[model samples]
Target: MGKIIIYEHANFRGVSREITSDISNLGRLDFNDIISSVKVIGQPWVAYEHINYSGRLMVLEEGEHNYVGRSMNDTISSLQMITEDLHNPQITLYEHPNYQGKSRVIREATNLAAGFDNDIMSSHKVQRGAWLLCEHSDGSGIQYIAREKDNLPHYSAIYLNDKLSFLRPLRPGQQLCPGGIALSSPQPCSWHPGCHPAPRGRNSNSRSPAEMGRIILYEHTNFQGLSKEFTSDIANLRDADWNDLASSAKVIGQPWVLYEHSNYGGRFLVLEEGDHSFFGTKLNNKISSLQMITEDLSNPEITLYEHANYQGKSRVVREATNLAAGHDNDIMTSHKVQRGVWLLCEHSDGSGIQYLARERENLPNYKAINFNDKLSFLRPLRAGRSY
Candidate 1:
């Protein structure tokens, strides 16, 4: 152990160096000598506030306490001024060529023995064989964390252990060995407020959403309840198909409005639900288009929900009726993106032809009902129609 000397220069810049007691130059210069004539390299300069080091032997020169880090070339000696080189040669982990899905490499599977980008929390540094977490740029969020080989470090996977055990580990061959947490004289994470414990297992609510597993959206062949991107498989669906779909996606299926998702948002395929069957159109892309399809009463009531993205100039359309039990019809609502507009729920064919609200008064010809509980029936906002 020797003095961790901070030698300041004429430029007001300072550098730190470690000199052994065996070094003759340091023994020759006492506290009063100018200590900058010696040479050192690397990023040795830092502002005083940034240095975590404290309290060493002090000696003054020229009737003043020397600001020991600047402009002098002399050296001071100490046995207790000790520091550890926490940095081991780090091996960055990269993505494997065989990787699939939208997974992106957040860190290489290499050793980051030098520790985290934030050194202050070095105790939680990604260990030599620890898992590395990576998030994708899409709003869809994380793709997944991949693991590296034994002691491979940086480019490792995150699912190596159960999430009950955290993935981030430390570099190998350190004072602390594998398994069990370490004992440090200094407290790293003090008992601080707002530090919520992370969730674990299928039941534990302690897990943070960022740490959750990635869900890849596979294309749904039968895009009955899904959006346009999930479009494709619905073929023999007559009227009975609606009931089956309603049960699977968990929505009431009476007066439903079908909609193919617009070109935005990765082009999803979807269907919206409604409570009224006829309020406006004979057949249009708005909810007002649902006309009478049934002749009998005393049947189960139906409702429809619609999905909307966060964009666009928000406005009320012909089918725009805010009803209940239709939230999943719109993931936009689930993600908190409905503040600015009136979103309509629709069906799978990109058609907004109807919703299940008012059953037709005149069943034979299939006409919409008068909403506002009024006598005036509003028509769908079609190319050239006025209700």
Candidate 2:
């Protein structure tokens, strides 16, 4: 059990309340919306804006909050102990672009209106957790979900599409589902296979857990509109009235390849174990067939070669990095992204012209951008967070 002390005044003075367990509604103890300072011991806690833990949140670690700060003073309505495998509170909000100007480092969910009521956030740094940057106060209005490792240079290109007014850090694996179709059942499988359930006795009503990978195709970007789930390769999507109309896709179990022509022929893009909002450029709305990639390419990788069809000096990338440090001047004539979407850039730091690659196979040249050896940098394509 964890213990937390809340004070009515700063520096731990005034009438206070001590909590050892989760309190969904602090109002029962006459402690609603009147917190100024806090001291936590042994466990982390999450405070909410309104009673019953149903408002903007702030995760507090074991420490002393001498002053709850302006954004959250006298505004905490409820709080609860956090037992999930959450990360330590470490998020920084900025008032200007590129992490410039005034800023606030938040270790808990916060309603900007409470403390920084007049602040307009233009950038942020999320060290962990999937955070939602809400446009309006108290976690409402247009919002953008920023995952771990996301370093957005501009907020104008994402959800809310402008300054952030409020922020909330979500527990790991949390899906915001913003304006997108919600899957009835989200699979446990991902790019890295481990926790997947083993095959058990067959129960005629259900397929074996071994075939748990379910691929969903959508007619619009970000998993919107009509969708169909499949556990097997579809050589012909026309049979299901879904030919050449796929604009987005979400994958589970293993990664799958989407073919532009039926029978797994013609150009194809690989949809890995994540969501693909937009195919980008010529790859969008041109899928005719798809099939699960059984070959276990356990690691997400992209290999760039100086020669066509896997030849010459090659550089394999598994994480986002500046290629200019080592291979800046090398000519990349061919490339292969085995399990994740990658953006090939003409310059380092992903600022120059780029191309999004989501599938496997050798590209003799980047004909889309009309360049071959021009790629000087590369990074993984992230869903819902990429500009």
Query: Per-residue CA lDDT of candidate 1, range 1-387, in tens?
Result: 112343444332455344432232333434223344222221111111111212222222111123444422343332221122213322233233223222222232211111122111111222233332323211111212222233322222432211111122222321221221122213232444323333333855343434222111111222221211112223222211121111112112211223222211111222232222222232122211112122222232222212223232222224433433333322221112111211223443334433232332111111231111111111221111111
What is the Cα root-mean-square deviation between model 2 and the actual structure? 18.4
Candidate 2: stretches off by over 4 Å: 1-208, 220-225, 263-270, 275-284, 300-318, 324-326, 333-372, 377-387
Tens-digit lDDT track of model 2 for 184-301: 2244445434434334456764645665566888767888755667779888776555676678887766767788788988766756667789887676877878877554344468
TM-score of the candidate numbered 2? 0.33
lDDT of 2 at 7: 94
- What C-alpha lDDT do the candidate models reach, one value each? 0.24, 0.68
Q: In model 1, where do residues sit more than 4 Å from their true spots? A: 1-92, 95-339, 345-387
